[model samples]
Target chain A: MKDNNRLLSRMFKYKECYLLVAPFYIIFSIFVIAPIAIAIFFGFTDFNMLEPPEFIGLSNYLTLFFEDDVFLVAVRNTLIFAVITGPVSYFSCLLFAWLINELPRGLRSVMTFVFYAPSMSGMLYVIWAYIFSGDMYGLLNQILMSFGFVKDPVQWLTNTETMLGCIIIVQIWMSLGTSFLAFIAGLQNVDRSLYEAGAVDGIRNRIQELVYITLPSMGPQLLFSAVMQISAAFSVSSVCMTLAGFPSTDNAALTVATHAYDFGMIRFEMGYACAVTTVLFIAMMAVNKWIQKIISKYADV
Target chain B: MKFKRSKTGPARSTAGDTAVFMILIIVGLFMLLPFVYAIIQSLKPTEEIFAYPPKFFVRNPTFDNYKTLSQLVDSLWIPFGRYFINSAVVTVVGTGANLLFSSMAAFAFAKYNFPGNKWMFSLVVAALLFSGTVTALPQYIIMSGLGLINTLYSLIIPAAATPLGLFLMKNFMVQIPDTVIEAATIDGAGILKIYYRVCMPLVKPAALTLVIFSFQGLWNSTGGSYIYEEAWKLLPTVLNDVASAGIARVGSASAASVLMMLPPCALFIFTQSRIVETMAFSGIKG
Candidate 1:
């Protein structure tokens, strides 16, 4: 009875904090959390938005893995996209941040603005459509024809061999976004005195300072950057859908998110789409956990 | 607040630095050329745009595309001003509500010792991993069930609680020394007063960062898919329809793209230096 009373009083003391934070929690629960729960529930059923959901045990998962060949292709493409783009973008952001940190303030700001421009522009990727327009008027074709390289203008988007490669190039071009900015912020936060002290403690050059002192000090931001990059790399659907047609030729640029979008929106098969996205959600969480483990190893250096 | 000062003194430039400078110049050009080309394309006459050996620079630039855009707007069944109003209302209300709610939640997490705080924070992290594609369908269902489909609430409510915005807010709040809050409390300030007067001013940089982020996001979003009514569509969706009318409207489409790109680009340019400076101080003080 005494312990219960103490607990009640403690809660009363912090009631205002609970009240202050309640609005966001309530909104998040409805919009984000509840939808996540509903999506996971739908994964176990077969529903097409017209009729009621019918529970089908594990058939949706079975169909995703065994029956659907395109689904497998999407899985493969998604993994490939994430594996290539994730690490490359991550390290390049660090590299660029390091280099930019050495410049004066005015130049640094300009360089930062330039690198971040592609992301801020609304219809930036439409230029890529013009460049690879599969005609003599296209930029690449004009250049190739001018040099007497190829007899014909190549169908870049329609050609299965080049579609995935082209998408990756554009993805990389626009990939220096949130994580890049975060890295810049993190690099700036490293204590100025630590470098001077490290130099006194036998740190010889910039390389040693980077590996030993700088990285360890920015532990929180590094972890934050890793999580952001991993999430962005896995969710490469909109860019793919916009650049190439939804499925693309021969499913070359089909990602799991795009596949799910096809099933869910276009086909109205919400259940199957739920299954596909659930798998993707799990994959992202596992990757995030792995990143945390890796980052923690370097965090204490 | 200038958190971006270089640690080491100006060192002698090396060959490696020269190589990096060259690479930056090339990369910068590659990045900005697309927008430049798009602007040039928007200004070109129809024949010039489709002309053989597609000219890199427009020979005769004109505001004919903008004139055509106004003509298209004149022909539309719905007034174009409605789209502008919808976007403006959504951006302002959504971004404002998001900043308020997120900062409030962040303060509780950062400054207050409360039950379930750790678990709640972990849930926010988990939410960060979720892709919107996963929630798109069910969210539509929920919005409709709540009768929020046609109303602007569907867009505004969802924008009010992004996990990333809250996470960043909480992180910045955590760096606000505990003694400051304690002093405020001992001075007879209530929780809300302390948050507004003491905490908010201190984290102005993070708040501005959230301002740019939330504003851009809300500005770019189209009306929810359930909102298919002609009167409810936002500017991006309207611009998309105009862009897809056919190849003949390509000039108008480019004009629309250029116009749509202006606000966010201008906002970013105006706030970017400050954002960097603000974010620089957002560093997790060890």
Candidate 2:
């Protein structure tokens, strides 16, 4: 059609721009976009690594929903993890960033480093494993015993009751990362004249100033941090695998992410794993869209 | 440099200031405790490491764990230096590729009014929703299909086009005034010259922040499922293996973590201010 021809001509006219962006799009198509397409396709098929995918016509999904008990548990655990960690971490990141923003520059940078250190350190969360080591010499166990809070070492990692809690704690501890920094930057960029105007406009306390001026100004950062936190909360895997062994005590910490890893990597059930991840992908997209809509509405207001 | 906002804004009461200081200190300590514990554990003598009712402070600090770590490295089947080299090469190359590709693409997205410009950039943003977990299985399939399995390119190439880098760079680039670019074009500068000579210098903070992010990610990456050969394993993988040996290697494990943490932390310290400055401009709103 004429529209298609015109679009093609426009593309040709801006070929240099296309050429400049080609490297990213090419790699992105291969690694990111292609994988999502393939994953969706593979979700409806039966394939292990060694075999060609056979069309299975929604059986994978049916089995995932009705037949797989572990999948249900994984979904439930993932939801709980996301619900608790997402909001808590987001608020904490905002609160901490706002507080740190008030400090003198020298002290502020040091405080930022202290909070952000745990996140940047590679595999240093393993230190948490030792702290929660379920042994007499473990830091937490020793402190509890000395204080007479518990009679004996608690199996924090191995116990189904406490495993998820330990993971959540560690996640929150490390959660003050990019989003936190974003909040700090966002706070710094808030117009100072507005604060002065608000003071003159009878904003008597810091809390009033924060609500009237700071929070509204920080809408974009709040959205960014929300998205980051939600994604991070849903994709909790490596820490779970490290602290509580894979398929933790009775799948206490078996999030959807680790479930997919279990099937795809460990059991070679690629089709089933793809189906599981497709569900996660859909859930994440829906939630992300919903949140973005809400935040953008609020921000516009 | 000085925090002038506090002086300009509503006056803080003594009680509120004290409470704020108290809460920050408590939270800061909580955030820092594990790291302090790890360093202390790493320094403790072997006997003290395993001593019942673990102490917070190391009484008899020593470097024996570090010595053991070096010895353990020396005994690895693959030379420890090979793993370090692999990690260094991956981090440097991956970060460089990411910066170059992302900045170019960002420049195009920000400055060009080409067909599919809006659509393609939105796709880049949408891709951020799909974390690595969602794509891991299919990416593995793609990697094998492309014969990237067990190769460094598998790690580097996929990482080079991350959405975060592109998002950050594009947002930064959009702030560059159009009149400046127009002036450059009028002065007989080509698009590439404008990008390189004019825009790149102006967006140095964003570029530096992108480098920090890419470097931290690549440095910490254990090559995941893509890498299998011991010779191609990164430093983290080697350190992890040592750490998982047993409780007897606890000292060295802690020592390994401390060593692993140093580079990123050091990089962060040097570039902290620039990173914050960059993030200020990264507001996602149009």
Candidate 3:
């Protein structure tokens, strides 16, 4: 009888744990789940917030893909950004993480801050805004002129050709801290014996060791970085907005998110915006899956 | 014959390696060059500021920018001291709540074996897929409906339950042994008690990491539309005003940027190594 009571009580206790964590599920379901559903469903319809939902089928997607020049531009800009910043940001963080990893713990952490500070450092957008201002007083222009590198102020943020690259560079600096930290975590977790084994195998230097061991051990993190960079490039907004004002300096700096803002928020083309987002979402899913497949293939190799 | 002729046991890094290293070093320096330049420029006195060729290092520096910073701000909006306090209140309370709630949820996921647990955990992980980046529009609309636009709570409430935090805490907590939970249960403890007293202490490292990230996220938020809809009084959102004002308080914008960034910088510096190795869990597995 006593044993049965203890078993029953233990079962009740487990239920209590479930109850404790239920709040997260409740809030997450309401806030996150419902909106995503709304977005997905509304993508297939012609419903703005002000109007009742009207089924438009895939017209929104069709228009975004076929007609919207800005959507295509966002797609191109996003891809270009992902491709350019991907390897550069990844390797930079790796280098920083590796550098800090070799040092004493106290000093190592200090250096982490120096590099990571920019990640969350306030008003980076504001400062960059000043630096990239269209006017002559902009820092980049002022400096270039003072150095005789240029005779006049360049519209760095305004120019379509250079605007995207400028934004990517700023982003790489402003937001890479987290990825860098992840690399450090991975680096620390690397088993010491692997290096010792390589040394015994007569591995000549750091480069060989890095390629043969470090790269392979860090495959998961590399995958993580790839995922993050792709998503980040996809969600590009603030850096562009700050560098150029809203409407994004002739709409050249527009990404899918910016396009959504223009449509859903600014123009109130909520249904059309949802359709655009759906396209972007499908594209990202395909890309993510494709990357995963490639990784698997390479693993086999 | 030279000893070098004896063996080819392992390939040495060639000139390519040295070249790559130099290139990487240059890249790292370039990465840092702007901030260094900003520091140098921030230090220059007003008289020397417009020198024909800008000085890479200031000759005679002053605290002029920092002083002018206060007077330069529109107190009705940002209200200098209030921005710091507002940022602090939001970040602290928000981060604290995230750490506590996330860890508790992570504990249940890791230790318990209830029905639907797997599905629930997967649901939680999917939350990571939808981020602040994409959810801002819906979130803004919700915040406005709730009448929480310009308050410090604007930053805290919506952000308090981040999916990444739950994921991070769970991943870390999984590494924790099951025996600890078993032992706690044997001691006649309640689930909340175990979560609060036992699991909380064990997950301190992960909690620290969560603290670092949440603080960064909340502090980094600029001009939540809902907030600007009502009143404009936060460090980050205030930057929008400072930027739009043109030449009047251009110096103040720079100063505000510097001031706004200082805490995160300090936090980054203070938790530098830890931020990477443990707390940030930036997932360096790559």
Candidate 4:
């Protein structure tokens, strides 16, 4: 009670500051926080859109784990997708940004555009659909045929064998987005004098300089990029849905987000979807925490 | 500080420079191929688009696909312009409100040592892990509760409070020298005055970066679950309908995508440098 009084008094002292932040917190609570709370609450219930939620403790989770084969496939696919794309995308963003940072300003901007444009153009990723389209008219098929690589037009999107691979390619294509930009800026902000000092300290190669100076200086950006890439990799759905149909060829490209989307939107199984999403939320937070620890450890070194 | 193009210590050998250039060019071309293909496809005549042994270059380019798109738009149940208007209102209002609110909140977090400041900022950061897909269903419930369902506000309100804007703005604002704020306070300026008159100007690059991000996001938004009314649908939703019609509408689909891409690309081109500038201060060290 005494602590509460002190806190309240402190808040009153910073009343103007509270007023400034109130709008964001209010809207954030209503939209983000409240919904998350409600979703967790509704996760236990078996609510269709029409009826009020019926409280059923742990049954939904039991069904999800024991009965749902499709959900299991989704979890498997999501893990695979995140594992491959997360590190690949993060490193590539760093590498490309570093390379681009070496160019003359005019060429640098153009290259940045070339890399960043795919991610920015909303739904333009469908162009990849055209390129990888399953017909003779598809660009890849045509090229392959002409080059005598394959006589048959490969069904890239429809084939279960190749569907996930195609989605990964497109995901990487779009992944050099916010993180890439942040890295370039971070590289720019790195103190150049450190490099000259490192040279004097017998840092002979560019790689050595990068390790001793650039990486440490970019500690924050690296962390930010890792978080962005990890979260994005985990929540891969819309691109999967667009390129390959939802519930694509034997659910080959199914992911956690798409699974939630399937139950929530298509099937109207609101409670099941909430449960799926809640699990996803927990998984993402866990991975985020782990990655943060690793990155901060490396940064400190 | 001006950004110098080259490092002084290591004189890069020509062989190394050539290797770097070669790799950059190859990767750059790979990154650019789909976009180039889309533009070419959009321009190709009907026969060229579906030609056997599909060619990389268009033999005869035409505006016919764009014409077809315009006709398709005109034939929609609601006026085609209504979707554009809806998108514009959502983007402008959403972006404006988000910038204002986020910057205000950012100012408090950065400048004031208020109680709960660290806790509140951490909450904002934590919210980043919750993707839109996870929250869509619950957001719909909240929207329906507030009677914002089927309204543009359903899209706008949620977007206006996104965590990215607040995150970016606060990071940028933290870089401003504390003495500047002290000077403003000494001049009898209030908190609001210092925020707008002093701090906002200093963070223009960050504000511009936020504007670009917010604008692009809101502009591309399809008003997913919360909006059901055809009249309230954004442009992308309507254009997506046109694009998904079938193989017959392929030309129009490519044209629709190119049209969708133009505004954001144009905006990025103009402000690319400013975005890079703003991102310099965006690092989040623990």
Candidate 5:
């Protein structure tokens, strides 16, 4: 009887502890988990919300694999985009963070504002759309023309090649602040004593110190942000749609998410869209898992 | 190695200072050029807005565009001022809800002894991968059933339960010392009082960080028609329309774009000092 009571009391304590964090789980399961499952199911069958789902299994996958041109286009486009922006964005953010950190205390915050202003504005698309407009009047074209580069004006967004470049450029601009701030935070956490130790051990300079120590120390945050960039690069849209125009002049700027939206909402090909979205989902998750494993080895956060 | 080790240094900053100065100048010019272009466009006459070799500087600046936009106050369903107020109300109320509820939930997870907490918190953290788009279709249906489809609650409610904010707060709260809570308990404080009087102050810096990110997200976001309006209007959506048909709508589009971007830019300037301080507090400082 005494043993039973002790076990019951310990159980009660753990239960109380569990109760503390219950709200997050309960809400997450309903909104996040349930919907994603529904999206998966929606992909496997013909369920258009208004209509009953008629189970159609592998057909969606088959068609997506072989027949659909846009699916392939989107996949190709998204991978190319991730390849283009991921490393460049990562380095720039770290560089910006390093610069911001070295600034005197009072001015650092204000300077970061200028760096992050485009992102904080929420109207990045608004400003950039005008600058990259196809007309000769566009700021960039005006610059090119004044420099005697083009006779009339080079179309920036309407073309096949440049539209993707345009989207990537704008994305890089908006992305720097969050990752940069996080990098700065991570750098601050590294003990200055370590640097002193390195110096005493005859480390030559800041460059060597940063490469051997600061970079390794900043690894966890860097990994998280890098992995996040991969996923974000895959899921990119809205700006492409708004800035470059959906069904872009040459279908050049069709990203994975835009394709999903186009097929899912605009075309109402629910099952097919789901299959495509599932591919994106799987690809993202695969990278996420790989990166998570990598981060697991390093990240304390 | 090159410079002899002097015990008393002559402020070895000048060399580093030059490098820092050059970096700042390059980055500064890169960021400033686009904004300066926007300002120039906003100030110029309509015809010149499309003139070849776009004007880097406005010859005759005018508020005529701003005046006209301000007067579009009577445009049928909503006006410029009304839209601005609506946006502010939703953003402020939504941010408040996020700060309160997420902090409460975070505190509970951080400090309290509760059952199923570990698996539950893990579940919450993992849910970060699901983007807003994936949740949209069903959430709309849920809101429809709740009779919130046309109300600001659609915007406010969903915006309040941000996974990112909750995650950020929880991460920060984990750093809060357990000793403070133990002292509070010794004082015979109730859970609610302990939370309000003790833990909340400790969490303020993190809370403030979330506030900036949350406002940035909520304000800058171009919410779909399903949330913001029965018609679903936000400045970005309006700007999208203007850009698509920009050949004829250049004046309105340019003015509208300027207005849309200016508030957040100004607000960013205002909170910039706070961002630095928050960075320092969160140990993201220099």
Candidate 6:
């Protein structure tokens, strides 16, 4: 009885603090946590929105690996997208941010604004349709024809061979987004004195200073950007959907996200979608762990 | 190691500086091309927009598209004014709530020595890795269950408690000096009072950064799932509709796209330097 009373008092003592944080917890739990839980549960069921979910063990997973040809293609494409864009974007963000950090303040801001604008602006990328338009009038075609490099317009977004490549190009362009901003901030946050100290401590140049001092100091920002890149890389359907049609011809540009969107929202196969999501979740977790391992090496140095 | 560090900044010669400037300009133009294209296209007359050899620069620029948009606003069977109001209300209210809630939670995590605080903070961080695609279907189910479908609140309320906002706030707040809080407490002010009057004002830059982020997010979000009702639909969805209506509306669609892009661009331009400063200072200070 005495212990129970003490516990009650302890809870009461922190009630205001809990109250301050309650809104986020309440909303996040209902909106985010609850949904995630539901998704996981639905992964084990045969649910098609109209009927109650009937439990089906491992069939969805089995189908995904063994029977779903389109899913296999999606898996391949998603991996390609993730593998190519992930490191390219991460390294570019770091390099550009590092370079921009060395500039004078006003010029640095202008350059940052220019690079950052594409990612932040809404659907401004729709202009790529014109640039890559399949006609004599298209910019790329006109440029190529002007140089006599090609007599005809090459279909950029429509042709199966080039659509994924086109999307990847756009993806790389937008990839220097939030993570780039984070890197800029992270680079600025690195102690100026440390570089001087390192210079005194036999650090030769900028490269050596970066290797010895900067990476170790900005560990948190590095981790944050890695996570951002991973999430952004994995969930790249919107760009594909906008640039290439949803089920791009031959499923050439199909990402796991677009595939899941097809099943979940369009076809109302919530169970199958959840199963697909589960697979992505597992893959992403593995990739995130790998990324941490890679980045932590630099953090430690 | 023979190389020496530059005292002024990272060491560079005139040639190296010029090379750096050249690279940055090339990259900047690559980044700026789409926006530049879109803006010029939005202003171009319809003939110039789809001309045989597509002109990079607008030959005959006009406000005809904007005029067409304004006159045809009511033809879509939904008042254009309602879309504007709905977009404003949702973005402003949603962003305000997001900042307040995230900051309050962040303050609690940063300042208070409460039970389960570490676990909760870890949860927020973990939540950051989970994408919206994983939760979209279930989110729809939850929204419909709560009868929030087809309402602006559906958008506003769910987006109010994002993990990123909470993480950013917590990261910033951890750097704030505790002595000020102690002083406030000693003067008989409560946690809420200290948070509102003392800490909140101190973290205004971080808050403004959050505002820019949240406004852009909410502004660009589509109500395709939540609200199909024309009255409650936001700007992105309407802009999408205008853009997809057909080739005839493409000119006006470009104008609409430019219009949609303006507020966020303006906000970003205004807040960019401050955001950079605040973000740069937070991690190391913390």
Which candidate number maximizes TM-score?
1
| Model 4 quality (TM-score) | 0.90
Report lDDT per candidate: 0.81, 0.83, 0.66, 0.83, 0.67, 0.80
Candidate 4 clashing pairs, residues 3+ apart or interchain: none
- For model 6, the stretches where C-alpha displacement exceeds 4 angstroms are A1-17, A191-204, B1-7, B10-16, B74-79, B107-115, B170-206, B276-286
Clashing pairs in 1: none
In Å, residue B33's CA in model 5 sits off its true spot by: 3.1
What is the C-alpha lDDT profile of model 3 across A1-301, one tens digit per residue?
9998876777575787678677666666656666676677877888667878799898888888789888887877777776777667767787777755544456456566556656656455555765776676577887888889988788888887778878887887865665676666555545455665787888776667777776666554555455565566566776777776678766778877778877877787788887777777667666666775665554311
Q: Compute DockQ for each candidate against the true complex.
A: 0.48, 0.48, 0.24, 0.45, 0.30, 0.43
Query: For model 6 chain B, where is the 10-residue window of minimal lDDT?
Result: B1-10
C-alpha DockQ for predicted model 6: 0.43
- Model 1 per-residue lDDT tens digits across residues A1-301: 9998987888799999898889999999998999999999999999998999999989999999989999889989999999988998889888887877666677887887777777776457868978877877888788887889988998887788888778887887787877676666556556666876786788765677788888887666677778778888887898888878876988899999999999988998889999998888899999998888988888841
Summarize candidate 6's per-residue lDDT along B1-286 as a digit string, tens digits: 1112232544345665666678888988999999888888888898887787777899878999887776667677877888889989999899989999999999999888787898888677666656556587778889999999999989899779988788777755654667878889999998888889888766665677677778888888887589987789887787777666778777888888888888988887777777555545543322
Q: 2 or 6, which is superior by DockQ?
A: 2
Taking the tens digit of each residue's C-alpha lDDT, what string does model 4 give over B37-142? Answer: 8899999988888788788998888999999999999899999989999999999999999999999999999899999999998788777766666466677768
The sequence of per-residue lDDT tens digits that candidate 3 reaches over residues B1-286 is: 1112012324444564455445545655755666665666566666555554444567887677666665556444435566667667888888887776677787888778765678877665444443233355566666677777777676676566767677666755654557877788899987889888877655555566667888888887764665654244566766546544765454455566666667777775655444444433422121
TM-score of each: 0.90, 0.89, 0.79, 0.90, 0.84, 0.88
Measured with DockQ on alpha carbons, how good is candidate 4? 0.45
Minimal lDDT window, size 10, model 2 chain A:
A184-193
Error of 6 at A24 (Å): 1.2
Cα RMSDs of all predictions?
3.1, 3.5, 6.8, 3.5, 5.0, 4.2
Candidate 4, after superposition: displacement of residue A42 in Å? 1.4
What fraction of the true Cα-Cα contacts (under 8 Å, chains A to B) does candidate 5 also have? 0.24
Instruction: Name the better of 3 and 6 by TM-score.
Output: 6
Candidate 1: stretches off by over 4 Å:
A1-10, A188-206, B1-20, B111-113, B174-203, B276-286
